[model samples]
Target: MTSVDITEARKTDAPATPVIEAKDLTRHFKVGRGFSRQMLHAVDDVNFSIGHQEIVALAGESGSGKSTIARLLAGVYKPTGGEIFYQGRAMSTFKSRKDQLAYRGDVPMVFQDPFSSLNPAFRVSHGILRSLKLHRPEFSRPQREEEAARVIETVGLTPAGDIMHRYPYELSGGQRQRIGFAQALAHKPKLILADEPVSMLDVSIRIGLLNLMAELRRSEGVSFLYITHDIASARYVADRLMIMYAGHIVESGPAESVLANPKHPYTDLLLGAVPDPRAPLAEGIEGDTGEPPKVIDPTPGCRFRWRCPLAIDRCHVETPLPRRLGENHEAACHVAEPDPGFRE
Candidate 1:
């Protein structure tokens, strides 16, 4: 993704409603031994909404629960707590497998590694044709072929017929990635959740792919939930941003505001980690130095207190919920709240 942060664009239409809404969404895994055995809070009380035609980027360090949340959204893992709604209807309310299938038709996912996502045994055309059949089984075989060619072309593959016949190993990384994008679009899904969609591609092709996603949002009114660790890239593709740390959202707001004036200590650390050509490069944000704390029967206090430079006694004793700090901005930090010294 591009590093440049353009000014935020205002929406002219009625604020588009969320196509995906996750309220207090959570996922816990049971691990460890006797007495230590406890629930690993992989995703902890996460809440956010991705509106129609909007792109909401989830930025965080690895193990901050971005991937876990994405899996939950994709129905690969059911949440342990909270609820997920697609277009305001509870996901659980879908009674039959057919209803569940219909609900999923509205949302599709694009994985990080295009090479792995496509089948090695199938040719590019076969891979895409299968996806089209699954996503819209009603489409006739000829219609499916036309749709596959159209989507492949939309993602910038030239002479779709030639590329479609090539096997996965035969295409360049960018071309394989374009095929992945084509698979997602074949269904004309209303929401797309991309997990580090361009991280594995060569730098030369990164911008082109990001620009393609941006163009799709602008032209087709497709909603996106883009997950990435690169703060610089997030600024380029996101409409609003949410910064997550230790399985919790530390700060969230318009991309410009959060990038320009980060409110939380953790968020500051993240932004400061971005590479800067003009500014002297200091020690970047450190990676996870120790194994994640046992998620099972975890401590009740702030999960980030051990690494937080601003931690106080209170931070070690109680978990702080989100506190609003500005218009469309919120932070889950005691220091950023009205009474920074109230921790005593």
Candidate 2:
């Protein structure tokens, strides 16, 4: 794995000003009948900020609301409560379509399945040109095509000309993903909401795609909200990490710090579950292990208490406030004692 400079990444040249911020961001869906209906807390009271040029990974198992948070940040889903800000301005108040369009230009998304995301009918070149044409009409057809070719090359799709006429099915999974990258980059977005960008690709190609993204961070300064269930990749790519469970942020800190020294029990479970071939595999957690807790109209207490090994009486009775564990490290747990053997 490539080593990331977490210290320098944490200390931005400019004081950390969130290019995108979500304050108590939440979304709940009503499930079941009127009498028995319960709200499904997809994302509840989640808060975080992404500084300019920062890559923050949102890690959790399925149903952890990581994808829901991604959708909310992308403006695909409106928050049921709390506020969203873009560069300190209220994103919710971006009333005008033109205003929203302008803001969206700065943020584009790369979905998990590149094959499904891209149009099957349209040629790769045509699809890219379509976005460019709609977003930048000033550019003539040739100019758009030229820029498209450049972008395709930038994403490591060498001999970009050969792939222009190909359909999504014609290319390999990695190549198709590169095409998605090209599409997202066509707008020169300041922030890219990548939800498991490499999850569907072949294992061998995952590293190359990750390297490409890291290169984009260095060369273009594009911030990323990389959503993934894979903790190892999160550790590899994220400057910082946010652990989510049952619609809430359970822990967050520098990726190395969180991985090395998990404060929350949920965080510890996540790190413990990472597959390490070299070490003797430890016994896994029991009772629906590796899955996030249920979120159905949850009572006013901790969601993970049901599965948490460290759960106490207080954990079952009330929600735990976020406790400071270390510098820039915080975890929402009643029993977040610092571990002495913490290091990356």
Candidate 3:
């Protein structure tokens, strides 16, 4: 077994404290009519941590529970089970109004759709100013306005004065998304849960938004939980990557290492789906085609068994515990094996 050195993978002297941590974090929704209620496990037994100034990308296909995890972290949805911790403090303990306010100020979210996330009736500056007023009440009215303009410029919206006054419908999709980033920045948050912030923007503008995020991480020491389905974009921006399938985090580790050598079959399948210029048309991983398993009233066992080619009897009867592949890499698979071509 090839072991990866965690310290080397970090490549930076980040602080020891974790910005956010999820311990057995699970969120299940009750679905169906009164007599036929069933549980939909959106996020199940997920465990991971993001350190200060780190960018952890949560990658999966649609309905893989990536957005649900983001909502849980952002405190939009209360967990059906498990706990979330921020800076070593349990989120459940923040029951007091004051504590909840403080937590929200420190942790802000950027939603997927810029058009819908922002208020259509209000000007762009109104959204940014509102966040600043809520999070930074100490700032005077003039200071708040100045800070709002600064953040707009910070997010790559040039001529902040002109852009700030426009309504959501007035700006282009890319510009509106930049406004979303500006709103998140207005709070000076310790952590940002960006749920597909760039998925809706134009291809020409995707790189610009990604570069802005990278700049924030470098300049401001902001930690991010970037949720997306694009593995290629995740690799381009994140330091660490977590792969989810059927509400389970099947693989996670340093981004470079995991992408170069995936242990789990699901991870391999996701990577194979990424568009490659060199590969011939219709050339990709075969036989793994089907709708994802239904989450409602899910049966016990590996959820990926229906699509996994390597699944065996044990896989159908038992749930595999996460096996340590290296110092920081882990995969939940009964038949996981090292790739011979993989190298550190």
Candidate 4:
């Protein structure tokens, strides 16, 4: 649907408390052959929350562990260490069949590649119908078909009659993505883990999908954890922004505040890279030339030390704890001075 229609669908209600919380979550993988096995710290001591109907963007470059965190939240991978709570209940305790089934219904995911998630052997409607039957078995055949069509229309694929019959290979990338959204919506989920949902689509189609997600949050009260590498898109769609580097969250806060006055050197480097017509081409952060540290058996100190322009002796010896920079704003940097503009 159009942006105007999506905005008009918003609800007027007070914000709700967090529906998902990750406390000191860590996930490590073993790399290399059996004799030379080494730990690859994919997600290290990361913590964050997603409130009801909120959209939190996780932004970082490739290999920064953004996708790893998303997988952990979606319950695709049990964290090697730490815990995940859904609506205040521990996810690890969901060992019973009934509990696992309930949790799956409550949390659905939209993958990065729409083609990979769909079945080429069946029509698009069959996938949505299958999800409906699995999640809402009470519905009869007619009800299931009606619900599927309604959701497909909700994602802005007009005249569901025409689109439902098309196979995955018959549709374009954008059409397949809309079907992905339809499939996720079929579950009537409380939250969605969107792993780079727009990174694979044409640039022109990205904004429309983002708008549809915002519409879902507004009208259906569905929360979203948007994982992406593009800082500009994150700023546009997120209520909160978390910046990750080498598996650690170095900075996080409300989107506008963090983007306006970035406290971490890595965050500044990322923001500077975004093309801005107002700024001259010469304006950019220097000393960001070195390669990111290998995640295998990483050092104890700050992971960004080798490339930070403001690195000091202490940064190489001790890891910096997350320090408060402003209201709801925190950064992990030994030398990041609190901006006077944010002082009480």
Per-residue lDDT tens digits of candidate 1, residues 249-320? 888988887888788887887777777788756655654243454355678877777777777899878898
Predicted candidate 3 versus true structure: per-residue lDDT over 226-302, tens digit per residue: 99999988988888899999899999988988998898999989988988899999685875965577688788789
How much RMSD separates candidate 2 from the native structure? Answer: 3.1
The per-prediction tally of clashing pairs is: 2, 0, 0, 0
- lDDT of model 3 at residue 185? 90
lDDT of 4 by residue, 316-338 (tens): 88988788889889999999989
By TM-score rank, best first, the candidates go 4, 3, 2, 1
Q: Which stretches of candidate 4 lie over 4 Å from their true place?
A: 1-16, 277-285, 341-344
TM-score of 1: 0.90
Q: List the residue pairs that clash in candidate 2.
A: none
lDDT: which candidate is best?
4
The TM-score measured for candidate 2 stands at: 0.92
Go through the candidates in order and give each one's C-alpha lDDT: 0.81, 0.84, 0.86, 0.88
For residue 212, give model 3's deviation from the true position in Å: 0.6
Estimate the lDDT of model 1. 0.81
- How does model 4 fare in lDDT? 0.88
Give the root-mean-square deviation of each candidate in angstroms.
3.6, 3.1, 4.4, 2.4
Question: Pairing residues by index, what is the TM-score of model 3?
Answer: 0.93
Is 2 or 4 the stronger prediction by lDDT?
Answer: 4
TM-score of each: 0.90, 0.92, 0.93, 0.93
